[model samples]
Target: MKRFFRLPALGLAFTLLFSTAAQALTPDQCRDLLQQYYIDDIPQTVLDQETIQQMLEALGDPYTQYFTPEEYKLFTSSMEDTVLVGVGGTFSLTEGGLLTERVFEGSAADKGGLQVGDIVTHADGKPLSGLTLDEAGQLLRGEEGSSITLTYLREGKKHTAKLTRTAFLVPTVYSQLVDGHIGYLDCDTYGVDTLTHFVDDMTAFSGLATSWIVDLRDNPGGDYYASMGTVGCFAGEDALSYLLDNQGKYSAYRTAVESRTMYPALVLTNENSASAAELFASSIRDTGTGILLGERTYGKGVAQSVLDQTTLPDYFPDGDAIKITSYRFYSPGGATNDTVGVIPHLLLDDDLADEAALLLSTPAPAGDTTGYLRVDLEWRWYIDLDQALSPEYQEAFVALLEALPDQVKVWQGTGGADGWTQTSAAALAEAHGLTDYTRRGFTDSADSPYRASIDLLATYGILQGTGDGTFQPETPLTRAQLCALLAQALNCKMPSGESQFTDVDMNAWYGPAVNALASMGLVNGVGGGRFDPDAPVSHEQFVTIMGRLAQRLSMVMDLAWQNRPDTAGDSFVGWSDWAAEEAWLLAEGQTGLLGNSINLLWDLPQDIDPDAVTTREEAAALTCTLLQWVGILPELS
Candidate 1:
């Protein structure tokens, strides 16, 4: 399917029109077709694109949508600032093929004692049966603060209940303290300045002043910018964020201003604080701005820009109504803080907190790896001038990306280091020195073509087959994976040193790799936390990683190759990470790598067989593309 999804400056412009011979489906008709097929299983497959479009025009409403959690996040962030949650009401087609019953559970109807057997004669005084159940339901669902008055027949009597629509803002933030002195700040919402508010609230703690806690108790966020602003306060005058886009470039930033707190801060987060909040808290903690105390955080590193408006296809909806991913953002240190949230330093739970404290106060009970690990973990996180990063190349090597892929077509098929999968696979192989050997895949017994490709890559040793031999491919690649992969891909030679990223756990398998990568300016994680070892990776994510590496290795490797006729002409320029000239390699298209770049989605089909693994055929395809990008392999067929 030749489709184009544009992330317009204002946001996504989904023009699924036939510019050539393709037919134009009016917005209305498109909406109807989707709804019809999605609901009633109606509508023809293909036709004169125009005829298909006209049919779309016949159905007037453009506001309805069927969404999963991920899709809903995109829809609400850019289109409708408010998304729907709890069922407003459910109705079925009557056996008479007319209007049968309307049930509103937990809504005013249910609250007012309405049931499933009831028939609604009118909604806000309008006849019900004439309106499709969806149309009626649409009228019922709306922005919070709007009221809907429904008149229904219950027990043979007509009754009315005026209900107000509210934005179902999911409350995910939880806060509390452990022991004494550790004032915990659990900020889960990037809900428009939630981080800032969290910081502000932290400043308000009037209690004792020893060690403080900032807890991100499974806090899924509301926005990225808000997350950055929140994290900025703690990060101080250090690069706290970066943006990643599809073109293999990133725009990095630091907190130029001063930090708010002088008091030592301890942050508590888990595999839940995502997006902005994750970015904010992770940066400071990683910098050892304070002690990060908790389990690993939920890694959600991709950033999405809502269209000019979030209430999509509704009033004032863009004619090109769709959510297009634009860019990804990250913490100050150069790190792929994607699906991998923050890992903790203390690694303490309520069960062990007291014992750990005594262990700290007293001594280890026996042959204690625990005490040794704790000390090294603290050194990795809290000490400045860490051994992992060379004093000279710290900032230059690590880069926080600018934006996520506005378009994810960063590679040709057949996997390679450029795409997220290859980026991940290659890193794992390199880190463990299994580059010459093949291992198992991410999954087992997959018969699909994609799975075959994954197996091939494993066989070729281009991609490391996991220890278990099954590629849990969909499991988001972790920050540690990216770091390990980058180091391995670049043929990274580890320097025996202290950890640089405050989040790196010295005892962890990826610890040394994390430090080396951080020192080289490859990737980072949220503040006050350790680098999470497992998380899924995204398209834009690896681009930023490559961008950082390209710059660091440029003038040495990638630059001279770019000026060749291969990069400048003969269609080679079309490559996602390709620059116009060799000089533009580090500068990222002369506008500079950190400039206002954007990319959200690409032309790749999402109908991926989830059960499949990455094969060598796929690896070769991707590897060839990346090899070309890194100036290693030539452009392919």
Candidate 2:
């Protein structure tokens, strides 16, 4: 959307002509122009390429380089389009050699006797053996009119011919759906009309998905407008980035107010993602519209511009040009990614590098660090173990355990015991980098206070809404619902046959969960072989069910603390306190042999109303905490 124009007369090629000037302009004039016009132009101190290049060399900036006319043209042409000068032949490799499939009639390849079905073995003196078809083809390409020597086999006879490089286009922007619903747009670079094509593809994708993965991996960079345009797609009228001139003056580039997409976005980057690509990803992340996932990017934070020929100083001519370091770009947060590139929010290992779709599908947790964990029955072990160790030792031990070789599958349990039991599953998950486990859908429930926990539980497939897109978190949780949630959260297997409760329908929605728990002896039938499926679960009843469930999970807590002499005057030590104390306050109370098990479960607020009827929201919060303690759920932050 931005346009640049040069002044007339002054726009004439400096090598051929000049206007009202006795002699050619000096480097000082060129320096002055850059100081006035460059986005982040340098000060008057550095006068010529020798001085500037030396300064840049000291700073270790490889991109600020001198460009001859030929190199400058090639660079500018690439920025305009992916069309490259080559011996225009579409090739396919065969065992014999590089076979020519199709050659444009007037192209250098066809005009040079490079016929279809010809097997090419070498270019110049370089043999084609072990070279990919694409690599061989690249060797045959150079500046237009440049000559290349190719050895080819035709009709079983080998012959060598020299060919000139000609221009042909290569595909750049590619868009498609990945993993059924995720829209994947891989942009190799931003060239002429690339933004137009990208906009078209994005419009097409809007109807296909509510989430997207914009892949900018290995993209070196392109025109300034194109970079701004790419960032504009996801940002509103906010500053996409800023530029700092040599004088310390800052200029901002902002996105158009009307050209923005609200769809949740995730940008894929890598160590090769640089310049414009880094800008796009950084803008997306800084604007609060997206998250970046992958390795750190290539730190090419400076912007470049071609010095107009007429504006060129006497040291250069029309056939020569230089691409100068115009300005140093800054991220939206005003941080420069020059030498140190932008780091991703989620650092992925190689196995997860291509799993962008899956990551995007998982709903991110609220900004709160605790929302990522889940509260479940297995948390007792972490609690007991932490109680036995000093806090500093516990922290160090966990770090050491996390650093152990994954093949060993070792995790420290209560009393520093080593075992292969299920209690060590969480540590194993961490060791193997298997963190993500849930895909929640409650992100749209904006007005709910329990949105974080609800979304987390839903992500893990432990709970879904009561239909109609509502979780009804405030409603009292019923016995059947609670049983179903517990079964799902614990991954309980369905048991055979039926329970003794007459009121429980075998074909009903909650029957399998009830039966599973009943078979495990974790739940009981009311009087007369009846289970009240619709009865609201009281705090005491909920605690009993959880305690029994914990026992089933091999984590048992003793009630002997209730009679502790140190806590004699306490009015009521309900199930909530017992669960909490068993998990965290183990050694403090009058309990004996407190190192039975360790559970790093949810930390309940001090004022938790233990005797109150358990609400669905409270259950979700508790479930999330317990899941975290047992290591079934990962820390969101």
Candidate 3:
């Protein structure tokens, strides 16, 4: 059967139109096609360029391209995963040379006795050291029936081999059982045979593996349909991604295949993981089907459609084609991986990511499994009762376990330096019905009145604790932090462009949050074009921000309180003059805009400080309350 390819990062939305005649495409034709289908409007000046290449260059879109007949053939052939004449292996450039990452079975590399770890120092008598991976690959690839002499280093020893270039299909899926229990599947690309190969591997490992690890590191992505099918193997039949076209229309691309099985999965990613790989990772993360480990992915959220005779039959009588960026895609959660790639649930170094994943996936030992709680806190954590602790600590652990809510019992710790956390069990349990079996706990704020609120936010990832596992509940909330927290709570898209505030650095951790909220008119600068990001946010200030946000979101505010005769204007005293009206609207009654009773200064007793800074705990509580009201988070019992 012939396969249609959808290379999300480079090429997508394939419309194959076979033709026999060859003809040169005019600049006008190219400009017309782009104007009709490009993701953004083309400038008239750019369209009037004298040549096709010049017009494309003026447009400045790297993904959009005009392909000659020969180039188009090669591109289609590659997308189809056809047999190619070359040494059938993948290589990564290293200081020494090009390191062989994989050697295809029964191909030129394997037949020549080239191993996975072999570094090719020279190809055809030319030194390959210090060359780019693509440059070295160019040197190694050749026509069929051609031979090339290769000099390589294996295990610190030099070796040479004369290999004849032969036709072979590049393997896309590789699977093996790691530690005899983890199903480790490495997907190279989302190609035509990817779904089939992925299913075959899953079928092969059906009963043997208890957990699964999908490695998408360095995967450049391909075949959008195949990706949807493969991701469906884990995330089930849900809307995996949404596509938005230039005409302001939205279309959902749901998982095309049924879920094979549901197991805790750890997906590994890096900067090179793009397009379909990002789609797979984002769907898994957003749907709670898996946890992502390693670095953020390559942000390539736009897709291209190959235009040919089918799309513009009159313009293209020849076999040539033009690829145009036609749509922008988003994750099921409505987050785009365009410029800001998908952030991992757990950030890990590439060297230790696999080991950490294996450790996290392994279940607790069976013997005396009492008092142990298996929790899926970003990744899996097994909390066991350590007998070595003092009686008080042990008793505290038990009490904490018993106090855990039913959801905690069914759901899945503090992470440690090695990717697992070892903190106070009592503090973790009291905070969210979770306890760490390791020594020490969140020493600070253990007895805070807002411990529950703080931990609840942490549990849901709406807030993060200090790196030392301490919830600094008393820490004053800053304007930047508030924006960041609100952004996460609302699942806002990361904003593009520079910071609006002159004082705000766009590269800072909180910059995206501030920019996103500011762009939506939910936030404002202090004065003089400065955001004053580090300034403490007072209670009234916070309330006023929330009130503005509610208005923007069109939330229904309780009118009964606003209209009540007893609710005098003086009741909102102590609030800043500029914030008095908003304060009343956000916290005047039980069914305020937040949908919960927020004890602002107006509700507090006289003489109580009204100008006090909002603490981190207060910020978390407010954010959580808003989330619950908006149905983004469930109300805690």
Q: Summarize candidate 1's per-residue lDDT along 466-568 as a digit string, tens digits.
A: 5666554444455676666555444444667667656567667778778778766667665665555565444334444554455443222233334444434
Q: Return the TM-score for candidate 2, rounded to 2 decimals.
A: 0.43
By lDDT, is 2 or 3 better? 3
- Model 1 residue 448 distance off true place after TM-score fit, in angstroms: 39
In order of lDDT, best first, we have: 3, 2, 1
Cα lDDT tens digits for candidate 3, 100-156: 877767789889999877999999899998777667878987898899999999999
Name the lDDT value of residue 252 in candidate 3.
81
Clashes of 1: 115
Query: What are the models' TM-scores?
Result: 0.36, 0.43, 0.60
Segments in model 2 whose C-alpha atoms lie over 4 Å from true places = 1-61, 84-168, 257-260, 310-320, 362-637
Model 2 clash number = 27
lDDT of each structure?
0.42, 0.57, 0.68
Q: What are the per-residue Cα lDDT tens digits for candidate 2 across 521-540?
A: 66787889888999988755
The alpha-carbon deviation from the true structure for residue 452 of candidate 1, after best TM-score superposition, in angstroms, is 35
Q: Model 2: how far is 122 from its true place, Å?
A: 18
